[model samples]
Target chain A: MSQFLDFIPKIPVADSVEDAMDLLTDTFAGFFDVIKKSGKFSMEFVTDFLVMIPPVLFILIIAAIAFFATKRKFGLAIFSIVGLLFIYNQGLWEELMNTITLVLFSSVIAVIIGIPLGILMSKSKVAETIIQPLLDFMQTMPGFVYLIPAVAFFGIGVVPGVFASIIFALPPVVRFTNLGIRQVPKELVEAADSYGSTGWQKLYKVELPIARPTIMAGVNQTVLLSLSMVVIASMIGAPGLGRNVLSALQQAKVGNGFVAGISLVILAIIVDRLTQSFNKKRQ
Target chain B: MEKIKIENVSKIFGRHINQALKLVEQNKSKTEILKQTGATIGVYNANFTVNEGEIFVIMGLSGSGKSTLVRLLNRLIEPTSGNIYIDGENISKMNKKQLINVRREKMSMVFQNFGLFPHRTVLANTEFGLEIRGISKEERRLKAEKALNNAGLLPYKDQLPGQLSGGMQQRVGLARALANDPDILLMDEAFSALDPLIRKDMQDELLDLQQKVRKTIIFITHDLNEALRIGDRIALMKDGEIIQIGTGEEILTNPANDYVRTFLEDVDRSKVLTVENAMIRPISLNIDIDGPKVALQRMREEEVSVLLAVNKLREFKGYITADDALEASKKGENSVINYVRTDMPIVPPEMYIQDVLGIISDSKTPLAVVQEEKLVGVLIRGVVIEALSSSDENEGVTENVSIS
Candidate 1:
């Protein structure tokens, strides 16, 4: 049986994929350049802006946002202040800022692209059928696989890292948005239509507002997923707390790795709580 | 004037619409069309005209296409093939812009589930139509407030729909449609979601509102009693076809088919019947012209124990019993007025038999069904009971009894 199986023709797999990637990179070289430059500039701006705020003031600001977002609930606010202070004390503040920038860029890009696509999918069966499988592929494919295209398009840097993070984080928001819009009661849509609401009016006034909480949940997921990609993104020259963890791993310094890893956890917890509070405010 | 005229309108849902519609034209049954072409005939060849300021109710059981017919009138569900005319303008052939304009300007709909936007406050929901039409903020706000006030929901204008009860939410839905001040109001089971008591209140309020606004209303309901209570005329549908269209009294007296008869059998007849339907011509003596002997003779001739006494102008005076008339004659009274008793129950001819049941049962004298000040008819206890219980076989008995 082994001999018979071995007699089958060998498939041309690796060379074809490599050649295809090379061709795609060549075809969209200028477009990729523009995206890479814009991406790097925005990422750097956000990082610099975050770094400019003193650690104490930034912690106070986050605590204030948490305080108001939770309708003056003291627990989340105190946690934000303390958790952010602990990260600052760990001496990973600059790396935390870089990670914040990466997550911020990726999540924003994902939401801006995801929502309309989700709405499109909700509105049209053809678009839903075409995009649904694409979303499944994007979500189920290993996060590392996106880095190949990210590198091919934007090259290794913060830009490719942001690109890969966006791909990894986009599917949830899109899927949730489609689900949310579709979940709106049929009667309400009919009422809107009965009132002579245009397509855009119905979407903006009825579908979007009703779907806000669900869409917000998706956005929270996207932000967290972007944050989770920080460690993986560090492999492509993305500088963040993830890079610190990577360096500690290379040097086999357990204590150093633990500190950086804990800082990432603190940031994750703060971001998650804040987004969740924002989501709950409307609800 | 006919505000809306729908002719040969049909709506078939699902694929192979052409085949389904062809089958529909060939008079195929709904089930057959569905099995053959995989299309459900929602409404088939519905034809009707709604007059301005009339509440024309379309009634049927679930899946009977009453809802689909109403939707077709407003072009919400596009007709497979038909013409819908609103004030002589063909709606089915209108472009998107024209249709939108028609919807915004000429018609608005209230939903069974209230269909209020949960995110918006009551005021905001009420102002939706005006806001969509680009009315100025202050103007739309004023109009919306007036509509809310009319609905008795002005105080709750700032509250979200979720915070309000189902009845209040439906009131907001009504106010929202009213804010647009469209020429036509399409209410698709508007009160079907409310508790029975609240539904009664809504129905009464709608009738009161109709009196003031007088807009053409096309109401849809599964409840025959509601249709009878509020509809100026009702169109009853069955199996996607209209079985009958008539006034409540007309339909009750003359049902078009067995389905309509069965559908209406469960309806509370008291709501549909009036004293006019049960009242009989009174045997009366003119008190100004007739003597006590004449009153006694009239009672004896009519085989009644008493005679209703009326003036020369037919204005109800009272009643005179045979004993009183005999006593009056013995006492040498010239007129029956001296013996006439003014304690007889007076009911209007338009009053429902159900309402007059208590009066007739409690009073010894028959009820005087007066129109204006004139004694037109009398409602006796036996006749009212017979009218209430009259079935098809006994219907002629009641009609002949009333005529005599």
Candidate 2:
């Protein structure tokens, strides 16, 4: 066997990877053309109904809920003011709601898939070795890059947009979940084993408890990534504050773009703070 | 009961091909498999049985395979070639499910670092083992409550392990082990990580707890004194083999070899020597109220030099000497008295010559009360030496002998 291995030629690894990339680029070009020819997809129904609820009222309710959960009155005040500005300045209260729904929906789906993948990675070295590189690529790859596949598969709509968003935002959740489970103290794992814990029992009771902080960190990252994806999702005809922001940018509506950007930042802060508060409560 | 045993157990690592190549390159024999693969000889032919309810101690320095030996008994790491029999059944080759059942039903382990679930509250951590056995939540909670109460950690039930002190966390670890009502407990240096004072307290607590439970315990530690304090039988290990296996008295008195002797050489015999074993048979002594002349007359007549000083009530006060009394008589003095008080520590009859010598050196006095704290006989070293050397037929009894 040693003699055989010594005689085997070293394979040309880099050439194969470059060829694969070329193939992907050509496929994406065709995908882009089809989406541009079709009418832009819209989730306007969700927006119109969501917009009917006064933007300030919705923001107040959300901020008030957050303030109670976190016990931070300052958070409520900031969220309320940010909500008022989006309503009065950008005049796209409905668009903000549409974006929030998209972010929340994709985040929920990402968490459902990503957490289990992360946990599996933690348990299995093989899984971690395979999935880790994929996670790195997913996180670094641009959200607009995801749109090419979304457009090809789902034909340019809010469903495609949300699907794309889920893919773009999933890496953090999965990576952190894996990290959290992996970070569980070795002694704790041994203790569980000594107690005769079956594989699943060890995972659920021992691994997960220690992993809560990392999982929450993943959730926070996922939510932020989802929010950032909103603007890219707009180019695929997903209607939201992201779409309004893009339109305002294209028409040189600086004032409107600024307000939309501020609302997105506020949304990111709210999600980040809420998850952190939940983590603190758990600890 | 024969709790566990290992024979010719070797766990080798590295790729099989690599190991083979290394062995061939080194021109080593099959017996040298461990060295070729860089695999540790964790429990090399470790063969010993922990009797039922015995506080069996496995003592060794770190990396001496004491921990590995304990882990092997429970099949935590499968022996490369050996069988362990627990209560007459071969457990070494038990399937995963069987091993799990055995661990759940019969044995529990306490780790040195406590290994408490930092995320779980003290109650939950205590209840973990019971939960793994498929016990109902309510039943587990009740059992956990009882275990915690026993370990004296009930007041901190809701606190997470991170919030507890090291001692309290270890108590939770113990509680978790006890909650399963295991027949045998494996402690791998369980108290070694605590502060010295806390470690002592925990050791006392363990002894007290063991008195009630009477579960067979296999404790691993490097501390010889601790092994002497708690162990009913001890296996002192070096490398991967048991150097000696004996009762505390056996190891303390007749250490198996130079290695075992060196380990016990620094041990304080008073701490280890029991008062019962150290009691001496009192020798008759003649004394007087008026001092020197009468004491000298009795010593000369008896042909023994020294006499124990006593009061009218016949309670021992100290020792007086014939030589001193004779010198005083010549000087026309009423008394010449220099003595070790009776209240001072008596060299137990069971004490080694080394310890007796140490006591003599420290006291800076001619005589010592030899009855340990009992009202046994006073001993003089010269007389004991004379008795030992004169009786050549009892040489084995004296040389390398244990005063049991």
Candidate 3:
């Protein structure tokens, strides 16, 4: 194990840190340019189109979907309507969207990498042995500790913030994916074999499908972790409702701070409900 | 012809140097071998051949290498040293691609658990085998649908596996196997996971399917009764070695050792046996409704205590007795339970006289059904022993036979 540990990539400290931060801003600017100019990645355009519909109508549709999927119609309706009202009252609807976009982007990337790593770990004993300790460290390390190297490389703004969130949020996905795949019943594997499934076919058709519930659970945890990281990421110039809340608290503005906090809670609720609804549909 | 054969299979783990050192240092006895190297022989030089279309059973308790034997046939686990031939192909040396090809083309297995994918619809789970074989999606779907229909799960085709009952899940597993159209079926205690009634139904279903398909099968189970019911040839295993291999009748009559005998002891031989055991010539002209009367008179003339009855069509009715007939005649009553079916394997005429004595000792009227090929007759326990003992002309001989 010690022999294996020596092989991991070491973080370098140099002027390259400043260079990376500049590169992150440039890359983000290029992405925004592509979306704004070409209409290829315009989340703003998508949101504005959505916003054209009456807010009440959109909320009702979302609430109904949530209610059907969760079997909690009353709760979903109350949460959805109240949360929307709070976000508008706090004057943070746009900031809430920006924070949500960060969480969504980071979590999606985390899932893409983490799930495959998990599946690989479950399949190979060596992969499991290698990845498990790293995953453990990632899970246990302080949220503050995640920011240091993140800041060193990408430095101040949404890019480093996304990176830090990924560091914090990624472990649950990988851990649960591996756990889910590993815990798929041994009899199921044999059944797949008996069904004349090739190695790849069995993994896709039998193993992954059977492991869906647990993998979705991993996804749910990743989403929640990403949400938690948003407030922390706010300390480093990643603008969102978290920044307003922090500022209000510093200025001793109790009403403003409470409203900002309530808006954050609403954003969290919307994301949790939406992702959980998608998960329930799949199951 | 043999469809599957395993020869001199010895699966040993650990390096040779340790074994060599232990061989030199310790006494070369069984206990010493077990203690010295901590070497456990999972399958010790085991060998067997399964013929085409034969229902071959490996029956053993846990840790007896039965499951290991099935896995070895499919190369699920590599053997330490051996040769395995499937339809004369040397499977032990097949590479991964070749092995997968063999598994996909020639054989399929059923697990103790149904092993349906919870996330997939029954149709998709069934189609999984075809997907692995690289069949087109449309073709696989059609094939899977047909297989599901055959297994009586077509109605549940769109439902996830969790939506089905245990028995239905097992049917889906069966449909999945059938979808591949493999030549051989390997079942590793497939019915053991089901409720008793469901297990019996599944076993009957398997037998019915086997009748239609005639696929060579290797079934594993710990239950001797199930082994007798399903197996064309059974291999009773102990400690990773086969203790006996024979047909049900052969094993029942001539168990190879005490261990095999222990499994046979509680077996209801009457149920296990067929009409082959109880055929004998009738002794009278009264072959219809008065057959029981002739049987009773014959019992009296022979000085026998009991008589078996049969109807004119030669279907076995029950047994009757002269004492009961006389008592019935006086009382004017007719009851069928008084008669013992001649088709059943009662204690044989040639069995130990002690068993004959025991049978007679308990019943007010004891009957032994006499069989010769398919013909059925009746024999009384007392008359059989009286003949055997009187002909020997030695009273000591009877006691010696009983003691032995």
lDDT of each: 0.89, 0.74, 0.72
Error of 2 at B266 (Å): 5.6
lDDT of 2 by residue, B1-404 (tens): 56655554544334564564455345454447655565555656667777787789999888778888888878776666656888777778788898889889889999999998877789998888899999999999999999999887899999989898899888988989999999999999999999966886788799889889989899999987678777888899887768899987677667789988877765544444333333334433434355577777777777767666655555556666566677778888765444323444455443444356566556544444444233456555455444444323433232323332
Clash count per candidate: 0, 0, 10
How does candidate 3 score on lDDT?
0.72
Question: Which sections of candidate 3 miss by over 4 Å?
Answer: A1-58, B13-34, B145-156, B159-165, B266-404
lDDT of 1 by residue, A165-274 (tens): 99999999999999999999988998888999999999999999999999999999999999999999998889999999999999999999999998998889888988
Q: Report how far off residue A102 is in candidate 1 (Å).
A: 0.6
Task: Between candidates 2 and 3, name the one with more favorable lDDT.
Answer: 2
- As a TM-score, model 2 comes out at 0.74
Q: After superposition, how far is residue A144 of candidate 3 from its true place, in Å?
A: 2.2
Best by TM-score: 1
Q: After superposition, how far is residue A95 of candidate 1 from its true place, in Å?
A: 0.7
Give one digit per residue, the lDDT tens place, for model 1 in B346-367.
9987676667878887898788
Model 1 DockQ (Cα-based): 0.58
- Kindly report the docking quality category of candidate 3: medium
DockQ of candidate 2, scored on C-alphas against the true complex (2 decimals): 0.59
Candidate 1 falls in which docking quality class? medium
Model 2, A90-163: lDDT tens per residue?
56666667787788778888999999999889889999999999988887887788887676566666777887
Residue lDDT tens for model 3, B89-183 = 99998987888899989998877777777777999888877887889999999999999999988998999888888888889988888888888
